[model samples]
Target: MASMDVSAQVSDEHSAARGHCDVELTHGLIITQDTIRIVDNNQTRVQINQGNQLLVRGQWIELDAKETEILEQYNQMIRDTVPELVELATDGVNISLNAIENVVSGLSDKEPEVLKAQLQYVEQALRNKFKRGDDFFYIAPQSLSKLDDFFAEEVSKKIHTAIQGSLGAMLIALGDALESREGNIEERINDVGTRMEIITAEIDKSLKKKAEQLALKSEEYCNCLNMLDNTESKLQKLVPELADFDLVKIKSDLQYSTH
Candidate 1:
């Protein structure tokens, strides 16, 4: 992974300037704010717009009552979940920031402005990826991929730099504070270490709860994908050209794990 020069002055504009890489999906679905597009094995394209208009092979197709009902059902499903998904993502970001703050609070009194800035950047990135439009939301495989990269590359670097710059000062301050207390310096240091471990364990437990929630949500999402699969199967029966086009295979790329 290539590293970008992150300036000391962390700002929203700077974070926005470091735009995400383009993600290409040769196959499967690509969902945007108002459209859902699928590329099949034979390179055939299928698109459905917000108006429930279906397009295939560069031509718009007229839908019967049943077909229109299926499309409406799918659209309703997505609409209902969009807010819930946004809430979950927001909760995840809050959980992460709280965990970081907890750890920092255990170490020092100083605010972790840099770390918080980076986390805010992450939150904004997530919001952008899962943007809600007038009547729809976006969901693409690349959203997860981009977030993974943000954490692994950008966030990790900022965290490492922050720790390196502050850890020694934090330790010295902690040591001086503890020195005035009863116990020997070494024993007090050990006690502080033990307390830090306990704090870390508590943070881990909280994170696990969030993970469980995410797992449950992933199951619901998988169910939705299955319904979409069934809907597409019905659509294929109605439109023979789409018989070979597989929209649900995008679920495989999702790799949602209960574990």
Candidate 2:
């Protein structure tokens, strides 16, 4: 593999400032200071003055000295479109929750906490989506931090991993809370043991599935590492193969690998 190099050039003639990097992008460009700019495969670019303005642009939107027309258009879209999408998301939960509850009820033996946990999860997830916060995915731009740009090719992938992570975190917390309730159920009726066992079994099954997935990825990652540097990864190798890997994390390995 031929190593890549990157540097910057400025218009100044007398004393030119320069910096070099070995950074690689799957489908994007990163220009370092003297004015850093990154252009994605889709031709969307993020330009920064290293400290001042950051611009993310792709396609024209007429933001110059335009009018109240565009402002009103965006405001209308935010009011109409945002709530419609929110309601749709909530409706989706309602439908899925009904189905899940139906199945849980069959096995629930009228246990209150079981259904409570599921409702709480759905309600809380939806609630978090609407509230303005650091974690909330805000649609309306405001005085909050903005993403200059994200490599477009990874949007679907990023969403998938994000949802998977959110679900995993919710399950871990729900399982813990339910575990406590299981004890109270035990004291009330010995038959409660069966239902708790059922709930625990379900949780364990989900957790196991997640673990298996992680293990598979870990194995693949180890194989990828071995491909990059067999001597370094031999002791750490776990996976026998890999489907594919990307260069996003290569620079992270240098310090530790050198040590």
Candidate 3:
């Protein structure tokens, strides 16, 4: 009779007559919802404690190096699947951001009259459907910035130049009257100075109000640009992780490793 190793003996008499394989794997088998029990060819019985623990109760059936390596490989393969799913989620976020940026840019690049009309529609929808009032003004930084650019380059310059030319003509006339030594020259000089003072004050007040409005508009534009910059920075940091979503490559690697 072959002397069997004492550590490899089975507890039940019905299972003791199995072949001497020294040790057996109790866990790490083909586990699914239906099947729960796993035994290694009856040489030794393995009682699964949980998902990954294998207990032999009274026996110390040890696994060889090959068996241990196989178990490690299976666990590593399972862990590697997680990063692939993360990459897919990141890709979806990137797609959403791209779509939003494209829509905003397209709307802004339109002609001024068309853009103004479109913004009016947007404002109405926000008020009617979304229940957002003049909040559209707060969110329309980019659209408003584009409008300001149009006004500054096309409208404000011509209007300011016309106003300055009119003021210069009035000043020249007043200077001519003061330079003469005619009757009531002193009265005309005082009258011209008073009118000039009034015109200067009005012009100063108008310019100050316009400057304040332009400053506010510029601040809004800068804030929007800053927000976009932050969003871009965050997306760039995640790009490498996003690029790792190669499903074909992951599957190929898993197949090659199994063989």
Candidate 1 error regions (>4 Å): 1-51, 55-60, 80-86, 102-136, 142-198, 219-224, 239-245, 250-259
Ranking by lDDT: 1, 2, 3
The TM-score obtained by model 3 is 0.23
Which of the numbered candidates is closest to the native, going by highest TM-score?
1
- Model 1 CA lDDT for position 159: 43
- lDDT tens string, model 3, 14-122? 1321111111111222222222222233322333233233334334334456444433333333233222222221223223223323433332332233323433443
lDDT of 1 by residue, 55-111 (tens): 887788898888878776765564554456545544554565566667767665664
Q: Considering every candidate listed, which one attains the maximal lDDT?
A: 1
Clashes per model (N, Cα, C within 3 A):
0, 1, 0
lDDT of 2 by residue, 1-259 (tens): 1232222122221111111111222323223323433344435354434223334453222233233233333233223333333333333334444544554444434424534564556446445433233322222211111111111112223323333433444344445556767455334434433454464455444434433443333333332332333321321122112112121223343212312
Of candidate 1, the 10-residue stretch with the lowest lDDT total is 17-26
Residue 247, candidate 3: Cα error in Å is 37
lDDT of each: 0.54, 0.33, 0.33
